[model samples]
Target: MSQADKLRQLLAQDKLHVMPCCFDALSAKLIEQAGFDLTFMSGFATSASRIGAPDLGLMSYGEVLDQARNIVEGTSIPLIADGDTGYGNAMNVKRTVAGFAKAGAACVMIEDQLAPKRCGHTPGKAVVSRDEAFDRIRAAVDAREEGADILIMARTDARHDHGLGEAIERAARFKELGADILFVEAPKTREEMIQICRELPGPKMANIVEGGETPELSHQELHNIGYAIAAYPLTLLAAAMKAMCDALAALKDDEPRTHLLSNFGELREKIGFETYYAASERYSTSRRY
Candidate 1:
């Protein structure tokens, strides 16, 4: 089946499908090899990794699209990218939606945070006016061409700014505007989480356990709720950071991997650089033959 059909099938199932967010080709390849059916091109991950900047809407559409294209090329799994406030208002959303779709993103999520927005999980988030956000959603839905299963996910940062009830109401409205998926970003407590699931229904998604601020639940538990999609957006990146810190500390002490023989070969095997080089050499040799 096509990726679109595969995604739709996964959505139709009774439980939430997990989409781990990937920062680069290495992460994407790892997720693919681990048998994840879907992944997200995280704007926050890309911005922080590439430039050491926060996801304060500092990254441009061009920058995001470039990263997204690389991630898509790296894996065959369906990719839902962070389009980041559509890089502007409604018109900009149209362009961004179309451009990202063409760039091989199976889907792109545009949040309702205003331009120059902070990260969704960050404190002090301010959202756009309801009408303004709705207009952006409409433009995003309208922008995609035929034969493009490029889904548009309308994410609301209003859970923090406007309260859960208002966020649910806004999500219902976005559903009416034909958002393929709805992300009510960052509900803090388990009660808040359950309430959002109950209140908002219809092709829904939740950013699972972002930054450990919101209540963390098992995948099975989240799927038991009505959430059709769940993303662990930064877990891999966090683990990677932790490992890097430990490794560096070990280096500083002149004890880097000294006793850590477990999977030393597996570490290089996970990167698979030599395998890629071998494949490239075979192709080059074939051309000469």
Candidate 2:
């Protein structure tokens, strides 16, 4: 099945999908190895890993699309891309959605946050006006309708500035605008989360940013709260960072950090050396380049 079709099938199931977001091709491959049916290309993690920068709309459309293309090429599972603010106005939103679809994203998430938008849990985040917000999603839906062959996930960061009520209102309108999925970012409490789900329709996504505004609820708790997808955007990135730091600290103290790594064979396998060698065997001998 097509990636978008697969995403639709998964979302149709009445279950809470625990998705671990990925930064790069290797991370995406590892997520598939761990048996996840879906994932997201987290802008925050990709910005940190690729450019050593924060996700304050610093990465351009080309950069994010290139990263997403690499990830999608390396994995079979469907990936939802983070298309922050659609990178410009309504026309830009359409182009961003279509580009990501062509890049093999199962879905492209278009948010209503203003230009140079910061992370959802970060300070100083603001969304555009209501008409502009709806226009963004409308453009995205238009892109999909014009043969993009991808889902449009509408996101609203309005909870930070306006209130939970405003966030839900935007998400509801997004659903009406033909968003396949809805995300209302940074709801503060469980009660607020529950209320957001209670009011918003369609398959809703709950972002679980550890130590951020939203409470890190368990998958069952989120499922009970009516969340269709629970996205752990930074967990893998943060854990990888912690491991690197510990290994560096051990090296500074002249201690072996072997325990922090997978063994040589397993590492080679994870890196696809074995698979590469096996495939190379198809060639009986060396051929001229």
Candidate 3:
């Protein structure tokens, strides 16, 4: 089966897809090795990792695609890309969606926030007009061929700008416009998270964080409230950042490589030399004379 079909089937079984947001090839490999069912190629993470900038819709289409392609090649898991604001109007969204779908994304989500938009959790967010955003979704849904399983996810950053009720209405309308998934982003409290969940059940979701603007809830807590999926956008990136910072700090005091062997095996094993050599040896042994 195609990757899209596999993802759809997994979601059909009401399985809670836990997609860790990955920024680069190494992180993607680490996640795949750790046995995640899916991946989220986060625009925020990509922009931050690649350019050291926040996710303010600053990167061009090519920049985003380059980073996404690297992650896609690094793993076989189904990925859902964050196609922020469709990069422009309906025509732009069409191209963006097709590009991401062709790049091995099972789904691509575009939000309603205005161009040069801040992150959902960030303050002073603005959204496009309801009619305009709806048309964007319609255009994207129309662009993809039928029965492709290239899911068109519609996200709204209006929860913080508008109110929960307005967010719910926009979500319902997006659903009416054939959006496969609805993301109501940046709920600040547990009560807000529960309220968002109670409002939109089944194939609708809320972005969860570890210590972000939203309440830090466990996967089970989110699933219990009828949330379809919980997109953890920064846990891995943040952890990696912390670990690297600490390692650098250790280097200032003494030889950082001195303890590298203590934590992981020697450099060669850590870099998978043994795995490659063993595979080579096995192939050599099994070769025909």
Pairs of colliding residues, candidate 3: none
In candidate 2, what are the lDDT values of residues 1-289, reduced to their tens digit?
A: 8899999999999999999999999999999999998999999999999999999999999999999999999999999999999988999999999999999999999999999989999999989999999999999999999999999999999988899888889999999989999999998899999998888888999999999999999999999999999999999999999999999999999998899888999989998988887887778773222
- TM-score ranking of the models: 2, 1, 3
Error of 2 at 217 (Å): 1.1
How should the candidates be ordered by lDDT, best one leading? 2, 1, 3
Model 1: per-residue Cα lDDT over 170-280, one tens digit each: 888888888888888888887887888787767788786555567778888887777788888887888788878888888889885655443767777777755766677
lDDT of 3: 0.78
lDDT of each: 0.81, 0.93, 0.78
Per residue, candidate 3 scores C-alpha lDDT tens digits across 145-238 of 5434488888988878688788888887888888888888887778877776676645866676676787767777777876777788888888
Worst 10 residues of 3 by lDDT: 258-267
Predicted structure 1, TM vs. truth: 0.90
| C-alpha RMSD values across all candidates | 2.6, 1.7, 3.2
C-alpha TM-score for every candidate: 0.90, 0.97, 0.89
Give the clash count for each candidate: 0, 0, 0
After superposing candidate 2 on the true structure, give the runs of residues whose Cα lies further than 4 Å from its correct spot: 286-289
Better of 1 and 3 by lDDT: 1
